[model samples]
Target: MSKILIIEDEAAIRRVLVKILNEENGDYIVEEAEDGLSGIEKLKKDDYDLVLCDIKMPKMDGVEVLEAVKKIKPEIPFVMISGHGDLETAVNTMKMGAYDYISKPPDLNRLLNTVRNALDKKELVQENKRLKKKVSKHFEMIGESESINLVKEMIEKVATTDARVLITGPNGTGKELVAHWLHQKSDRSKKPMIEVNCAAIPSELIESELFGHVKGAFTSAVKDRAGKFEAANGGTIFLDEIGDMSLSAQAKVLRALQENKISRVGSDKDIKVDVRVIAATNKDLQKEIEKGKFREDLYHRLAVILIKVPALNDRREDIPLLIKHFAAKVASEQGTIEKEFTDNAIKLLQEYDWTGNIRELRNVVERLIILGNKEVSEADVKLFASK
Candidate 1:
């Protein structure tokens, strides 16, 4: 249900707003305040999804209320109420962060549409906040080794800029983690970080997937759709396994990098996008370029800042910490007690070759947690952790 607060000095206007909102939808729980001072008091006491305030209140005005609310609860959408003479003031309120303004004797259609749009924006904002928290929790860089520290230091230096990054590493060495870290630390963290696995999509459809298509663009195209670049405007787009991208798509990607624009698969018009590109691949792009499979110019465009994540076997000292981290993570996820790996068990596990990198180690840790004894021992590692 959406909670709406109406702050108008006029009793009749407040009643009208309450009636219109309550009758428009049963889910709308409308509340009223006689003046801006009372309105702010109510706001402090309760959470509101939207606020409609009159510009000319007796004790406090809409402008003052808006400024106050911005400091305390900036997420709530504000709609200013304006009389004929207050139209200029109402317009100014928008620049001060009011969502929109409605003239006195509100038009039902305009009022309802504004309210719906504001509520939708509020929902989107809240969802973004939730996803950011989830990303921060799930993608933590859980090592303090020199190799990992170098990657961390590089991210700190480059994340503040819009420079394109190319992350090169073996499979499962946490290349994606580095991408997420770059995005989260960057100024575009509020916007989305869209991820596309270039190798996972079919070669024939990769172009359409990166640059959207209009209806009838292909046999499967039923309607016009936006692609990852469009969706990631004002944000970051992580292209994983970019080495596998087809040459046709590579040309289009290069064009976008050069001009900051892309044409839909079937459309002649180009759409301008302000997106930060971050690409990752396990394959050696220089080798791919020599083999004529990858574009050299495209590689140069994406590799403005190169970050190579070290494989797990190269940083064996972090294995014990990783095991403990994974054990606690598995216990929390599975609703069980965290298991402790014996020192000998960790040493033995560290000595083993981890060709599959961090991804394989996480799977093995989870398996041992389930199959090993209360305390994971070297014997359990030998039994359940065989390559």
Candidate 2:
């Protein structure tokens, strides 16, 4: 059931609102207050999903009540009840964060529709918040090692800004995880974080993929499309394996970074974009630049903040923690209890060279969990974890 609060000074109007709402929907539990002051008092005591506040009231006005409620419970949708003379006030209240407004002696359809829409919006916002929390947990940084802690510190300082970040690391060192953390912790967290693997796309189509194509731009382009940069407007665009991007695409990317704009493949018209660029590469970009495979200027632009992810072997102390984390995650996914790793097993695994870094470690843990005894032993590591 939806909880609604109605605040009106006039007894007759309040009764009418309560009656209409009660009749409109049996699921709506409506409460009333004689004026704004009393309404605020009730709001402090109860959690409401929506508030229908009258513009002209005794002791306190709707505008003041709306402002106060915004500070305390801004999520509660507010619909202002406006008299003919108070229509302007109602509209102004919306600018100050009211969900919407209803003119005096509310129209039945308009009131009902507005209330329903507001409730729907509230639900959507709540769902998005829940999903964000879940995503954050899934991508959690799971080590307390000094190297990992330094990376976390950098993220905390720079995630709030729009500065571009260039993350460099060996393959499978969780470069993508760092990128996700930066975007999720930033102000643009609510917006989409679009990822493009530059190496995954063909050289000839890389430009088209990064900067969408208009219809008939190319033989394969049957419809107009928005590119990653355009799609990531008001959010972030993560360019993974950027060292593999063609020099031509690199120039376009540099232009986008410099001017905050991009042109589609088939069109010359520059489309403006507002995006935070976070790029990662497994290769040494300086060497690539020296070899003429990458642009030096573009490197400088993207490296406003540089984060180097340590290889798994370099932080072997974190291996035990990582194994436990991955074991729990894999077990949860497979609907089984997590298997414990014997101290000897963890030490034996840590001594091996992690050429594939954390990615390789996770695979080994999953294999051990599936093949080893309830408590994984050093012998289990030798049999199943051949790396």
Candidate 3:
């Protein structure tokens, strides 16, 4: 059921609104307030899906009520009620976050339609928030080691800004996790975060993949297509394995970083993009630059904030925590009872070398869970988790 509050100074108009709403939909629970002051007081006491406020009222006015409600419960949709002389004020109220407006002696169709739309928008906003929380949980960083803590601190300082970040680490050290955290905590989290694996794409097609292509630009280009840069406008684009990107593509990426623009393959027209870039690589880019495999200028442009993730071998103290986390995660995913690792089992695993880092450790934990007894033992690690 939808709860609505009608705030009108005139008793007759308030009654008509309540009656119209009640008649229009049985699910609508309409509440009334004779003045804006009373309406605000009621709002503070309980939650309402919608608010209809009169532009002119005694002791308080609709504009004041709208501003107050925005501060307290900005999610509640407000539909301003206006008289003949209040039309201009009604439009201005929209700039102040009002959902919509209805003139006095309201038109039935317009009022009902506006009310439904505002409610639908409120539902969408709520669903987006819920999904964001789920995504954050999935990408959670699970370690408290000093090295990991330093990376966390850097993220906290840099995530809110539009700065470019270069994440460097060996394969499977969770370079991608740092990128996801930066994008999720940024101002542009509401927008999409497009990920492009530079090494996965063929060197010949990398340019077209990142910059799009017009129809007939190439044999495969049958239709005009927008690329990662355009699709990531108003959000973030994460470039993984960036050191693998071709030098030709590197030049184009450098131009986009410098000018905030990109041109499609075989097209000279520049498309402006507002995207924050977060790039990661497992290779030493400085060596690549010296070897003429990477661009020095592009490296400088992307390294505004550098975060190097420590290898699992370097942070072996975090091994027990990671083993527990992965054991639980794997059990849940496979729909089996969660297993406990014996203290000897955990200690034995931690002493082993993690050449493949967290990725290798997780695979080992999953294997031990499947093959070991209810209580995983050090013997199980030797039998199932070789290397």
Candidate 4:
């Protein structure tokens, strides 16, 4: 069911609009306001899915009413109803946040279709708000090492701005984790956080994946579709493994970063997007640039805030703390008492190279918990966690 408000100075026009809405469907809950001031008052008092406002009105006028309604309920869609003389004002109303403008006397079919579309858009906005809340709640950064702490501090400082962030680290070193935290903490956190793995998607499809294509744009493009940039409007996009992106895709990615616009592979028209991009790469992009595999200008665009995650081996002092954390986690998962690591066991384990970083240590901890005796000993590491 939809709740609609009709705000018109002319009593007969308001009544006619109400009748059409009621006849189109009883599922509509129709309400009326005879003037702009009264309409804004009504809007404040109740939650309406859509508002239909006439341009010429007493005291406040439709423009005033639309502006006020925007401040009050930004997501509630408004459709302007205008007389032939109100065409210019109606167009202005749309620029002032009206969902659309309809010239009066209202066409019955057009009124119903506009109402349906406005209500649908309202639902999408509501769903987007809900998803944003969920994303903000879930993407919390959990760590206490100096490196992790520095990352958190930087995120706090930079999250409110639209600067590009480039995260560099080894696999499972949680570059993705940092990217998610940046978005979740940012001003755009209330909108979608679209993520794409440059390495995972096929090279041919990467362009279509970032910028949507029209129907018949290419083979396998069975229908028109919106791309990630369009989908992430007023939001953030995390491009993971950017170093591995195809050269052709890099060109498009660079354009989007440079001009804040992108073009679908088969389309010549450029689509403008308001997206804040945070990218991650495992390889040294400078080295890739030297080898003629990466773009230098693009590197500068993405490295506005370069954060290099220290490899677990480089941060060995934090290993014992991490080991304890993982031990408790693994013990809970396995439903058994956590094995205590003797000081010797901790030292012996830390001395070995952590080629796989934090990820490998976590696996070793699981092995220790499942296979070791009452208390894990230095000998236990030798027996169960060799290399």
- The C-alpha lDDT values of all candidates are 0.94, 0.92, 0.93, 0.86
> Which scores greater on TM-score, model 1 or model 2?
2
Q: Report RMSD (Å) for each prediction in the order shown.
A: 9.5, 6.5, 6.2, 10.0
Query: How much lDDT does candidate 3 score?
Result: 0.93
* Candidate 1 residue-wise lDDT, 247-326, digit = tens: 99999999999999999999999999999999999999999999999999999999999999999988998998899999
Decreasing lDDT order of the candidates: 1, 3, 2, 4
Q: Quick one: best TM-score, which candidate? A: 3
Alpha-carbon shift of residue 157 in model 2 (angstroms): 0.4
Ranking by TM-score: 3, 2, 1, 4
lDDT of 3 by residue, 185-230 (tens): 7778989999999999999999999999999999999999999999
Q: In model 2, where is the ten-residue run with the lowest total lDDT?
A: 128-137
Candidate 3's C-alpha runs over 4 A off are 1-135
Q: lDDT tens digits, residues 21-41, model 2?
A: 899999999999999999999
Candidate 4: the clashing residue pairs are none
Say which prediction, candidate 1 or candidate 2, comes out ahead on lDDT.
Answer: 1
TM-score of each: 0.67, 0.68, 0.68, 0.62
Q: In candidate 3, where is summed lDDT lowest over 10 consecutive residues?
A: 129-138
Better of 1 and 4 by TM-score: 1
